[model samples]
Target: MRSVALDLGVHEISFCEVAGGAVVLRRTVRSLDSLEDLLGPSSSPARVAIEACREAWAVHDTLRNWGHDVLVVDTTRARQLGIGQHGRKNDRLDAEALAHAVERGGIPLAHVLSPHRRAIRHQLAVRRALVETRAQYVTTVRGILRACGHKLARCTTEGFLTVLSAAALPAETRQLVGPLVTALEMLTPQIALADAALEQLCTHEPVIVRLTTAPGVGLVIAAAFVSVVDEAKRFHHAHQLASYLGLVPSEDTSGGRNKQRLGAITKQGNAYLRVLLTQAAHTILRHKSGDDPLRQWANAIDERRGRHVAVVALARRLSGVLWAMWRDGTVYDAQSAAVASAKGLRLQAQSIEQQAQSMKEASVKARRRQRSIDKGLGATRATARSRPVSTSRRASMH
Candidate 1:
């Protein structure tokens, strides 16, 4: 049996091959594309195995395309079964160990991500990184401005630089801020171009289209969700997706009893996806209309417990909703959600009604103010007319 493994590193990818449990080939692949030359044409089908890494999916896809039966193993289990415990850790041992582990079935196998999916996800990952980097720079610039007692307006619709540049900043502060403004100016065009690329990607992606069906999930959130999960079928239920996203409550159970504590999210898996989901949840809470069952549940919890807890709870629910929609291809329906989750739905409607009432009152007050202003203006005009402008003396005399 000819087997191969790649010792994945940030800067370098080392390759090792084993035949009949003996080291026969060793080479470092500079990039994923270089793997083609290493695997020679064998008379029979070859069994290849490699530890799951950031680059594992791409590499796995490439190997599979070359007509090899590739096994992607969980790195943790592979570590437990082989050379990880040994004093010396190197490419040679890791490759052999992966081969042995695969032959023995000691490690759980990883799914080979399709090239199409990998390409789509790669685009999403790049977009995500750029967005986060842009946010970091914006925060840094804002901090500098705030430190000097100059406030920047919060407006993401316009580019960060546009907002900052339009500010009436001190000349000295502007001098210090010029480079940051210029950097943001540069990033803005790149971010727009990236967003257009992502949108084009979304046009053909069914999963993204399904994810975006939920009320508040935009293209960015949908892309992030799809990139992270890859396959919703992998998870059985919404709770599974929630747990995967670290949206579920952490449990403390002992002595045959389980205790629930209110703490920050465990934040265990796919932090980026969780943030996107939570942000989407917050948007729904703020802007969504109608009798949403999930919204009702959140408001009730907020009233009984607190706003923070409610928001988290809602976020968890949102995860399940996303999963259900993705898994079943069902569109969102208020009546259906309310029927299924009556208590949560009722509470959401109540909250919306309350907001509606406040708006209604504000509208009434504005109308009354307008009427009063109109009445006062009319009286002033009548008085001016009654106070008679002096007639021209020549006309009166004629």
Candidate 2:
């Protein structure tokens, strides 16, 4: 079978065909129509390699429809395959590299998400952008007012207009800030609409509904998790899911040494999902009661470590817990969490008590050793004194 590597660009596509360990065809096509024309109708299907990019999925779908086997490789891994190492890097070189990689086999393939999951991801991304833009405008308004010596009170996005209206601002200042205020006003409604749409989407999703049962998880977080994860079965275990989300710590090991020093999270996966999980963890820690096992565990960690460490740990734990819930088709179990928390607390108490007892025994042993040394010195001095006077008297008589 032949292999075709395609380096896709906005305006053109550079491609190469390899058959029987030789470059059989190399060309540049200006459009999809031209590409089809060049390939022509053929009975034998060639393996097509496309690096995962913005247009990769669309291209993959098109090629698949054309009856060709498509392999979408991750861009990062494709680069690491020594593509364009010696000469000037260009589309042709990249295409050649991809072709050779395909022939070599073992190319890392990118997971193409389902259309439903992609739609949800798109909606979430749009909503996040709108919210961020609104926040930027809000900050700008606050800064402008502060500069003019008319500071407005901090208010929610919905209440910002009222706050701005009540603030006694100079006419010139108001004129300058009016446009930004209008922009914020426009953005607020759009954001609300997006939120409403997202809420409706979440309400229909059983996964999101089950996720929301966990403490600190609400509609937004649950939806975000569902959108990003797509499928719970992708992960074989809860820890694997956490690791995929980059919630786990990184490892640095050397020859024969099994030193596991935990550092900051890798933060390699979806940034938005990680942020939502962290926010949920923070909410749980701040507002949840001790009666809940997860809350109790978090509080214990917060007391031992600082709030920041506790929050990150809780976030990682939350990922694991959510994955477990999803995989098992079970809701959050507060009672079980509470029981585990109690058991952990008991073990901690016992460890502390054992440590204190060991310290006390060591202190007593040290005191006894000191007393024994002192007695030995005193006895030696008394013997010397008792024998010394007779020796001195005998010497004087002689």
Give me the runs in candidate 1 sitting further than 4 Å from their true place: 1-3, 10-38, 42-44, 76-80, 86-89, 157-163, 251-265, 339-398
Q: For model 2, give the 10-residue run with minimal summed lDDT.
A: 341-350
Model 1 TM-score on a 0 to 1 scale? 0.73
Using lDDT as the measure, the top candidate is 2
The C-alpha TM-scores of every prediction are 0.73, 0.78
How far does residue 99 in candidate 1 sit from its true spot (Å)?
A: 1.8
lDDT of 2 by residue, 1-398 (tens): 67889999888999898766678789898866678854545436778898888788788888878788889987656657667687668898889888887787888887787677677778899889988898888888898888888888878865787788988888999899889986775666566567656655655577776676678886678778888788887877667777778888887665767776768888877899999999988998888776877777888989998898888888887887777667766566665445533111111122455445534543453355345434434544554576546787889989
lDDT of 1 by residue, 35-146 (tens): 6566544334567777778777776766776777778776545657576655767776676677666566556775555556666677877867766777888888889999
lDDT, residue 344, candidate 2: 18
* Backbone clashes in model 2: 0
Worst 10 residues of 1 by lDDT: 341-350
